[model samples]
Target: MAVPEDWMGAPPRQPVDLHTDRPHAARVYDVLLGGKTNYPADREAAEQTLAALPNAGAIARQNRAFMQRAARHLVSEAGIRQFLDIGTGIPTSPNLHEIVQATAPQARVVYADNDPIVLAHSRALHTSHPHGRTAYIQADLCRPGEILRNPALREVSDNFEAKGSHVNARSKGEVLRFFHGLDLVDPGLTVVHRWRPDTVEVGAAGWSDADIPLYAGLGRTS
Candidate 1:
C-alpha cells in the first residue's frame, strides 16, 4: 500500500519557549512516571501533589493501565483502527499508540497535548509505524474542534477508513461537539477510568469531581 507522501514525514517542530521555572502538568506526570524529561520544579510539584493524595503514584500507574486496557479493547474488540488522544502527557513507553499498534499494526493514532514538552517528546518518540501511522498535534483539550479538524488528524482519519476501520478521538466536552455526526460508544462522555471499569459499582461510587481531572469519550463516525 502506498502511504500518502505528504503524511510520510514528521510534522515540523514548532519552537517552544519552555518555562522550567514553573511546573507543567506534563512534566509533573513525567516526574511521577519516573521519566527524565522533568525539571526540579516539576519534581517538587509532583511530590507535593503526591503528598496530598498519598496514592498519587499509584493513581498515575492505574491511569496508564486503564489507557493500555482501553486501547487494547478498542483494537481487539471494538475494531477501532484510528485514535485521537488528547491531553497526551509525556511520551511514556507502551503509550496508547504502542498498545493499539501492537495489536493492530495498521492502527493510526494522533496524540495531542497542550504541553510544549509533550509536543517535543511526542515528535521524538511517537513516530508512525511503517504499516500504520501516528502524529502529534500541539493542541489544548479546551479546543477539541481544532484537534478534530487538524490536517494531521484528518489525514490519519482518511487512512483509517481506507482500511475499513473506524476512528475516534478521546477528549473532554470541548471536542464532543466535533463528533456531532458520530455515535458515541456506551457510557457516553464520562471519565477515562469510568469506561469499562473493573467494577462498575465501585467505580461509580468512587467517582468525584477531582477523580476525573479530564473527561474522555469514544465515538464512531456515522
Candidate 2:
C-alpha cells in the first residue's frame, strides 16, 4: 500500500515553510492513524503518547468510526445535506463528505484547516461525487472572519437548513451544555465508541470509555 511521492501534491503557490522541527498535533494524529505524511518529530510525539496510552491507536480509529457513524446518521435520519468541517486533519479515507454524500449523493461539504500540509493535500478533500460538491479552505479557527468571508463557505452556509447538529466535546459538562437547549437523539452524549459502534471495526475494548475519553452527541432544536 505504498503511495506515490507525487500524491501529496505539487508545491504550494505561496511559500509555506513547514515547522518540521516541532511536533504538530495534526501530524502526530496522522501518525496515530498510520498515515505517512508526518515528520520525525510527529512520530516521536506519537510514540511518547503511545508509551503512556497503549490503546491510543485503537482510540484514534474508534474516533474516526464515530465520525462516520454520526455523518451517516445525519444524512440517513435527519435529512441533512450540507456540512462545514473545521480543523480537518490530514486526508483520511471515508472523510465526512465521503460518508455524508454516500447517503445523500447531493450533499455538500466545506473543510477548513490552518495547516499548510492539509492545504497541500486539499485535492483529496475536493474529490466530490459527480452530484455533490466539496471545498477546502486554509483558514484558522482563531480568525473566524477569514473562514466566514470565503465565498464558497458563504454560498454553502446560505443554502443550509438546520435539521440537526453533531457535537464533539472534551468534557462531559461541555457536551451537556451544547445540548442544553435542544432535544438529543436517542442515547444522548456518550463515549465516542459507544455511540453507534461497528463491532467488526472496533474490538471488545471499544466498549470501555476509559480507552477513549472523547464525548459525542447529536441533537436537534425542539
Candidate 3:
C-alpha cells in the first residue's frame, strides 16, 4: 500500500530491525491469529502458552474485539476524531484507524508499538483515507510520556478541536490522567468485557475491576 500523502512529509523513516531470535508479544499474537508474519521462535512460544492456557487465543480475540468496538463508539457516538493507541499489535484488518475513519473520515490516529515487526507492517498497512490521517511511531508503552510527547503523535492531539477528540493514552496512569481532565462515560474505567459484555459467560470470565490488563472507557476532554 502506498503511504498516505499527508504522512509523506511527517518524519524520516526509522530503521526497523527484525529480531527473530527471541519470541515477541506482537509476533506471538500474529501466530495466534494465524498471520504469516511470525518467526519460528514466536510460534513455539505461542504454542507453549496455548498449551498452558487454552483460553489465551480467545482472550486475544476478545481484546481485539473490544478495541474495535471502543474505537467505533468513540467515533460514532462520542464524536472523537483523534486517537493515540499504544501497544498496538500487528496490523490487523479493521485496525483502530480503519474503524474510526469508516465512521468519520476526518478521524486522525497515531499507532505506537515497540516491536520492529509491527513497525514495519504498520508502516505498510496503516494508510489513511484521503481526508483522514494516520501515523505510526516505534515506541514502548513503558514510556507513556515519551509517546505522548512525540512530534508525530502530538500532531493528532493538537488537531482536535473538541473536548473529547484529543489523544487519550491507554495505560493505567495515563487512562487515569485522561479521565482526570475529562468526564468518563457511564460505567467508568472498567475492563474490556465489562464495557459491553456480550454474554453472561463472557462477563463472568472476563470481568476484572481491579487489575485488568486492558483499561478502556470513553470520556469527554474538559
| Residue 124 lDDT, candidate 2, scale 0-100 | 42
Ranking by TM-score: 2, 3, 1
Candidate 3: stretches off by over 4 Å: 1-14, 154-182, 198-216
Which stretches of candidate 1 lie above 4 Å from their native place? Answer: 1-12, 159-222
Query: Candidate 2 — what's its lDDT?
Result: 0.76
Model 3: per-residue Cα lDDT at residue 122:
87
| Tens-digit lDDT track of model 1 for 1-222 | 443433435444556776889998888988877788888999999989988976566557657766786788789988988887878888888888888888889988888887777777777777666899887777876666677667778867764331112335444555566556678877776666666676443344766746645555666766
The alpha-carbon RMSD values of the candidates against the true structure, listed in the order shown, are: 7.3, 6.4, 5.8
In model 2, which regions exceed 4 Å deviation?
1-13, 20-22, 142-146, 160-171, 200-207
Q: Judging by lDDT against the true structure, name the best candidate.
A: 2
Question: Residue 164: error of model 1 in Å?
Answer: 25
Give me the candidate number with maximum TM-score: 2
Candidate with better TM-score, 1 vs 2: 2
For candidate 3, give the lDDT of residue 219. Answer: 71
Candidate 3 residue-wise lDDT, 1-222, digit = tens: 554444535555656777889998898998876677789999999999999977677667667777887777788887888888887888888789888988899888888888768878888777888889888887877666677667787766674232322446666677676566777876788666677755454445644554236676777755
RMSD from true fold, candidate 2: 6.4
Q: Against the hidden reference, what TM-scores do the models get?
A: 0.68, 0.79, 0.73
**Which candidate model has the greater lDDT, 1 or 3?**
3
Candidate 3's TM-score reads: 0.73
